[model samples]
Every structure is written in C-alpha cells, then in structure tokens.
Target: MSSTIDESAYVEASNGQACLAFKDEKQEARFELGVSMMVYKWDALSIAVENGWGGPESAEKRDWVTAVIVDLFKSEKIVDVTLIEETLLYAMADEFDTNVEDDSALPIAAGIVEIYKQCDAQDFSTVEKLYLEWTEKQKNKEGKRIVQVEEDPLNPDASESEEEEEDVEFEIEDSMAVDEMTENNTEPVVDEDGFELVQKKGRRRNN
Candidate 1:
C-alpha cells in the first residue's frame, strides 16, 4: 500500500485543528480541544514525518510514527482520559491511512513519544505563531456567520416561529398529562357472579 497519504483527506480549520477523513468518510482522529492542543498534535505529526516516518514496508518507521502520537497525548492534559487509547489508535490509523490493527499500533505509540521529546527540547515558536493566525481566521469566520444570520431576510419571523413552536409543545405536554390523569381515575366495570358487573353506558343504575 502507498504510504503517501492524500493531503485532501484532511480538512484544516481556522481553529488550528484538522479533521482527518479516509476516502471521504470522516475519521475519529479529529482533535476536539483548544488551539494549543491542535498545535501540539499537528506539530508532533509533522516532525515525525519530517524525520522519515510512515514509509512503505518499513516497520521501524511505522512504529516510530505511532510512538510520536502516543507520547503527544500523554504529555498533554487531555480533557478525557478514558479516550486516550481510542484517540491514539485512531490518530495512528488516520496518519498511516490504514486499519487500526493493535499489533501495528505499539511502535507508532513509541514514535509519538520520541516526537514529543524532540518538540519539548526544540523551540516551537513557529507553531505558536501559526496557532494565533488560525484562531484569528476562525473568529472572522464566526463573525461573518453571525452577521449573515442577522441579515437574513427570509428568517425575519424566525423568533416568532420559535415562540409559536414552544407554545404548541407546552400545550401538548399539558394535554398529555391531563389525559394520563383521567385514564388513571377512570372506573372499570366488573362482572358479578361473585364477580363484579359491567357498567353499560346510558343504562339506568337500578337496571
């Protein structure tokens, strides 16, 4: 299999994070944290690649790449620890464009650790600058989205529509509650043969 993963498979965002996909299907390796975390992951992966990782038919190179990813997660203060193993596996698969086989994942994890060590020692000022620029772009994009929503002529009655929907929902909920209560209070007829008798509608009580 070719080790030259397609750059188009990843979608870069202004938030400094990138969402990786395989053959148009979004992968689970997307970083869900802040820009700093995004920087960390990208930089680590870039460094690993620069050092000749992820080559074809090279077990050592593949293992090194995996290690770089694992170490990156460990050094960072991840929001969810439970997702560590899962994230690591997915990230490796995303990078290599392969199915996440456990046997192949260990070396990749080690490579991730090595990359982190290098990053810590080397100056990452460039990465920081890139992160700042990315965030600014994100802010601008968000601002435009807000302005668009505000200026939308078709959505002039959106608030009113939302309010009407809420009112309808409230009335439906109240009606359901009342119906349940009525059903609970309803008297059931019993037969009498030592059993209770059925109460027919429109019948005289003494009949």
Candidate 2:
C-alpha cells in the first residue's frame, strides 16, 4: 500500500522548533503499531536477523531498532522520510555491520510515513493490509523452512571424517548459541503510550 502525507498535520512547533505529534492518543497508538509491522516486514532487516549478523541477539536488536523508530515519532516532531531512512540504514550498519547501499530503506520509510498519515486520518485500511500481508509471508516462510528441514536426510550410521565431525560440532555449537540467546526472549507488551514494555531477562543456563 502506498500513500502521501500532509506534513502540516503531523508537525507542530515545540519550543520554537517543529516536531512530529499524532493528532490524538488513538492515532499515536495506531501509528506506533504500524511502524513496528513495517520494521519487521523489511527484507534487509529480516535477512540480517535470520543470519545472526548482529550476533545471536539479532532478533532483539531488530526490536530495538523498531523501538528507536517509534521513539522518533514520540520524541521528535519533524521526522521525515529521509530521517527514517537514515535511522534504518544506521541501525543495520551499527548492529549488523551491513551496509545497505541499495536504498532498500527508502520504501520502508515511506511506508511508515504513510502509516502515520493514514492513522492520523483515522483510516486503518493500510495498516490492516500490511498486517495481513506480513502474516501471510510469515506462514509461507515457515512452510518453506519446514519443507527444507524435512527433505534433508539425517543418518546416524553415516561415517564421518574428523573435518566432518568438526563441521557438525560447529553447527551444534551455533544452534546452541542461538538457543541460549533466545531462551530468555520475552514478548514485548505495548502500552497505551505507544511504547513496548519488556520483561526482565531470565537467567542463562550453563551448558
């Protein structure tokens, strides 16, 4: 879904400088949720997280990027497409060491701005469409991964050289690392203030 915004509606003067603010509390909440969905839907970010480019905490780092974007709406009033795009690019570079030179963040930024405009007008159709599309993509993604795993044969009786044993051990260690990183992962609880309330991290188990 594409859209353009009336910049005047979201910007207001605060201490003699322009800042972005939603029309009302309801609008703010909706816009925040939309931003979260948009962040998650970005493929560049998805690849970074899936590949653990930002380390085993890549997923949480992605959420942190989402929160940072949401905070821009909350704290800054003059946020524009350029600013949002910069933020995404910076997050990828800083957290994942990924340089997104293809300008992939532009559309996501535009989508976020469009979401803000739609929510400000009390029109949730765009947000709904995004949610539905994201859900479908996730389902298809999981299905494909399941198929790949099922098709890969695992034979316990197969003889392995030392190099093969090392590779298998590496895979096992990597899987354990990811599990360790995520074992304490908690679902974010968004409040009426359009911010996520994360639970305290759990104790890590010793291997």
Candidate 3:
C-alpha cells in the first residue's frame, strides 16, 4: 500500500547493507545487525507469501514476520516484540473487531495491501503509532499492552477494505470433542485441506 513504510526518524540505509544506519558524522557506524536482519527477513518473507510459496494456513508466519521487521530494522531496539506485536495486532484487531485470542494471528497488512493500493490516513495513524511505540517498547521489553499498545479510540491506520474485515466474525465450533475423563487440551481435526475443525454436534456439511 502507499508505503505504510516510512523514512527512519534517526537512521538511514544505503545499498550493500540490507538495513538502516545510525546518524553519526564521525564513523557513522549503524545499528547494522538489527537493520540488516530485519530488512532481509521481512522482504524475503513478504515475497515468499506473495509468491504462494507456503500454505494458506502458513500465513501464520506473517506475524512472526512482522515481529522481526519492527524489532530489528524499524529504529527500534530488541526485546519489544510482544508490545510491538500487540500494537500491530490490536490495530488489526480493532479493524477485525475480534481480540487476538479469538482469531488467527496472521499478518493482515500483507493481505490488505494485496487488495488495496494504500492504507488511508486513519489507518496510517495506527501504523505510525506501531513504529513509534515499537521503538519505545524495545527500549523497555517488560512493559504492558494496555499502556503501550492501546491508543486513543479515534485514529487508526488501515485500508478501507481492511475496514470490512475488522469484525472477522466466525463460528469456529459447536461442540468440541472432550477428553473423556482427564483435564487436557485437544487439537482440532484437519481433513485434507488443513482447516482446523470438528463436526458440528448434529449437523452435516450439506444439510
């Protein structure tokens, strides 16, 4: 989309080094490691998904992918993945109208960008905050989300169509198969296509 990407606040990156550099008149040494790794990985990950190199469900990799981008290259320090994630997640969450715990943790931006050319002002604001807060959170990893990720309820950064998917309503299960007599977790069943599901109590697919 219209460069949800932004110029660095205090850094720059030239060719031959896949990342952002620090502002130093003397020596000009950069935060090369984080920048290089983030740029390399993020670009590669995006390209891979765009090229259909992974499963539809493999889309889960996008969040892990976004985490690396903000954590390493975006003028942010290491250790803020959680808040950084929560920021992007919540932004996407608000658009989707569902908490992360309810839906799949995939990168919605790539999907949105796939559909629209630019994320409008309201949504761009969220992306802006995501970059800023991510940098702050990296400066302090153990911070909380209510304080770091959530922002004023007015502004947001995303595409108009992104607006459409916000609520992402779903009815995932009717009755789950329980462990007969033990306290434990049971994963869902996946038929050939990898969709996680269990048969609806008394309903079949067509009837």
Please write out the lDDT profile of model 1 over residues 33-113, one tens digit for every residue: 122233233434333333323443222333333334334443444212223335555644554444544343333233322
lDDT of 3 by residue, 1-207 (tens): 343432211222445545432233111111222222222233333333333333342233333333343333334332222433354445333322334452232233332221111121122333333435545644664422121223325656666666556535432211102221123354545434332222222211121
lDDT of each: 0.33, 0.65, 0.32
At residue 161, candidate 1 shows an lDDT of 64
Worst 10 residues of 1 by lDDT: 169-178
Q: Which one wins by lDDT: 2 or 3?
A: 2
RMSD of 1: 27.8
Q: Candidate 1: where are CA atoms >4 Å away?
A: 1-118, 143-207
Candidate 2 residue-wise lDDT, 1-207, digit = tens: 535443322333356544565647666666766787888778898777766678877766776787788778767857777888899998899888999998778888888877776786789777767667765665554321111122124555545663365344111122212233457583445576434433223322222
Q: Evaluate residue 6 in candidate 2 and report its C-alpha lDDT on the 0 to 100 scale.
A: 34
Q: What is the C-alpha RMSD of each candidate to the true structure, in Å?
A: 27.8, 8.7, 19.5
